[model samples]
Target: MNRQNKISPFLIIVACGLVLLYLHGCTRVRPLPGPAKPPTKAPAKKTEKPRPYKVMGKWYQPLPHARGFKQKGIASWYGKKFHGRKTSNGEIYNMYGVTAAHKTLPLGTYVRVRNLKNNKKIDVRINDRGPFVRGRIIDLSYGAAKKMGIVGAGTAPVEVTALGRPMAGKSAAATVPAYMPVDFYSGNFTIQVGAFSNPDNAEKLKRKLSRIYKNAHVVNDLHEKTAPFKVRVGACSTLDQAAKYETRLIQNGFPDAFIIAE
Candidate 1:
């Protein structure tokens, strides 16, 4: 073997070391990614406020909840004259649907209306606001009225019990009665002694009640030309106190007095 022809081991080892160092300098050693930071939490939504509306010269505030609500009053209905008209809740009036209109209950509320005359009962979803005539509690569709025996008489005494919004069924299926728990949480309660078409009359009643009550105020729409003024008294924090207050009011002189949510 010619010794000059063979490369020296030292040179070969040096060349290999240089090549490894060059490769190391050229190649990037990427670090393993660190644990991902926890995702940021999303902001929560805000609670919405209830909307109040006016009808037939009166301002009506919708109830926040329908728990433990009961009312006794006249119930009437409408048909062909308003068959395709849009209701207060923005639904097209269907006279044949098992729906009703109420002055203050929430638009999506479900109620059990009992005809006091014949004890006939029907469940109706409150999809509109109406029956603004004094002493009337609810206005039913022609179909609902007929089911509860209210169509022939034109009007009937009814005991309306609030059943709240449906829990297991869609509100669109109002024709098929759904029984769900009423979700009425007690809040501020007051006695509505009277509601008058005249502002002066409401003020007079308020003044009279202020003599014997702690808080007697007139809820009015003085800005509106046709809105009726309501005289409410006794700002009780609970429903029981309001019931007692209403009883006292009825006994004192206001026979038409009723309990109302504030």
Candidate 2:
């Protein structure tokens, strides 16, 4: 045994410590920042606004002197499919009868319809609402077109004249009718100079009333339980004008003259 070959226990322990240090250096784990912070809530999205429709054209009524009341467009007739159905006026639709549909005009309105191509004319009651398709002005029932001699062509050039009154069954002899009364909500009012039991009497009074007022019209209240016929004059824009007319009516033999707000 040589003295150089002999090793002390403390020297062996020192060698083991150096080996452990080398292993730790080879397998070192890098220090990482704290776990990633959860993403902060994002701000809420903004809301959107609504859009409006484009109006193609303005609406108007064919005036009394609008002789060229002619509007050229597609004319269509509704038939059996719509028969027996309730019209916009709440009346049962009879396609076999002479009736028509109009937009804007009041339900139960009366209109004089003429087929320009055939020179045929007919009185049609507007019981429903329509001709909703763009460019078309009136929708006539099957019977109405046949009366106007337009069924053969299916569609024809036409002219429409608004009647002086509503379309319900009361005869022209009744009191004045309100075609398009000034809205009562607007505080507009009118007065009747006379009430007639006969249409001829009403017509005579109408002529006289027409001379005094620009908006004079005849109206029939078919829905009324009594006094079905009534004639109304001047849709005064103000209560004072209506009262003035009422005074004139009283002086002219309508002793019971009263104001009618429409």
In the range 96-197, model 1's lDDT, one tens digit per residue, is 998999987888888899999999998888998888888888999999999998788899999999987766646546556555565454677777778788
Worst 10 residues of 2 by lDDT: 60-69
Give each model's whole-structure lDDT.
0.82, 0.65
lDDT tens per residue, model 2, 11-52: 999999999999999999989889999999999986321111
Using all chains and alpha carbons, the TM-scores for the candidates as numbered come to: 0.62, 0.40
Model 1 clashing residue pairs (backbone):
67-184
**lDDT computed for candidate 1:** 0.82
User: For model 1, what is the error of residue 113's alpha carbon versus the real structure, in angstroms, after optimal superposition?
Assistant: 2.5
Q: Best by lDDT, which number? A: 1
Regions more than 4 Å wrong, model 2: 1-74, 166-262
